[model samples]
Target: MKSIDPTIVKKKTLIYIPKLNRRQRTIVSTVFAAMLLLAIILGGLLISNERITTNLEIRNLSPSLEHPFGTDWLGRDMFARTIKGLTLSLGVGITAAAFSVLIALALGMLAATMGKRIDALISWLIDLFLSVPHLVSLILIAFTLGGGVKGVVVGVALTHWPSLARVIRAEVMQLRSAEFVGISRQFGKASWWIATRHIFPHLIPQFFVGLVLLFPHAVLHEAAVTFLGFGLSPQQPAIGIILSESMKYLSTGMWWLAFFPGLALLIMVRSFDILGDNLHMLIDPHRGHE
Candidate 1:
């Protein structure tokens, strides 16, 4: 056998490797995070109801290869239940967040373009919504609507829009003063026309990032209300319901009941949080300057 030369080994070790800049890194990470969340959503959707069936014979099994997340006291697979619950939560989150974004878009534009009295009224509405804690508002809305998927969705939609609306309002206010907007107005274009064509187009990136960022909050709030008995029904396979059920068995040494479901929820929320942050970074104009 030939002995390896130290100098040749050192030269090979010194070979240059290019490092990704902040923008490139952000793009790569955003893609990965998106794919991971998509996989979880898809997997949860594809899993059948049979996998989550209760069987007292296998009840309360610990985590193992056969049952990755273990079994609940009723012998339902925790993994399946967690995935299903997450998918349901995702549905609610997406629906609520989309509606919330639409609300923000309309109110934001109205407040900026509809003149002083309208602006003041809209601003006051925004302030009023912002003044109340979201949970308190959400609970009231959900309860008044009679507590189910519809109630939860509408409640979350109504409650989550103020912050994003404020951001959009500020952006539109800034855009209203732009030279192109003034030129458009002078050239016989209506305010609405200038807004939809010029200002709204510029806000697409901001709206998309805001939508993505809102998903986690919507999902979390939905779960919270459900846990508090003001959201989804007990029959629904929601994460909140699962958690509420798990509390009874926790002292009985069935730690897996609460542990796995909560962990999965956190992981899903964190994934969206990362995806939104990276996408915002990727699109930001000042990012490269920094």
Candidate 2:
């Protein structure tokens, strides 16, 4: 047989479909991830309100075609419950992450632009928040705030901002010394004007990526607090409550109750994580080559 060159084959393959450049790949992945997330979220929301009814005749059934996620002890459709809970979690995650990012942006801007005393205070606050264990702090906050959806949202929002804030502060501090900023200062532009016009625009990419990165953490923490009975009420069809209710039946081989819901939650979290990472790669110029 004639000698076959792997290089020739590789070149031919590249010619047919041309390997996707980093930017193209990043865009593709980001869009796919975003679409998947949206589908899950919207699908969940569409069906969430329709799942309140129960049927005792089908209670406690295992996974089957007729009842994909299985029937809960209350004869509730596990699929519907899981979807509903996921929708709720997604809503909470988005809200909490947005609030956290806003707080971070404000504190970050303040720390970067204000006097050394203010910078020191903000840095100290960031360090203080970072020093505490996240879950413990979250639990404490949720408990103190009278444990519920609102409490979980607030807890997640408050606890997740420090790292992003530090990043923002560093970025702003660097932007402060940029050539254009100096030119603006020489032109007698006020600090507020420079910030609003220059600094904020540059920070948009960072803010978007950071906000996305905060979402999975918010969702997981919300679910955790709920599971611990410090979040949404048991009456609510939340993933945490579903899992909590499933524990009693695990001894009897009713594993699907917890399994399906937990898997769904894991998938949702992972999707958000992938979406954030892809967005980061898409936005960061240095990483664009990769």
TM-scores for all candidates?
0.95, 0.92
**Which segments of model 2 are wrong by more than 4 Å?**
1-17, 48-50
Clashing pairs in 2: none
RMSD of 1: 2.0
Residues 171-214 of candidate 1 have per-residue lDDT tens digits of 99999999999999889998879988999999899889988999
Give per-residue CA lDDT, model 2, range 167-284, as digits (tens). Answer: 9999999999999999999999998999999999999998889988999999998988899888888888889999998999999898999999999999889888988998888677
TM-score: which candidate is best? Answer: 1
Q: Which residue segments of model 1 deviate by more than 4 Å?
A: 1-16, 288-290
lDDT of 1 at 265: 94
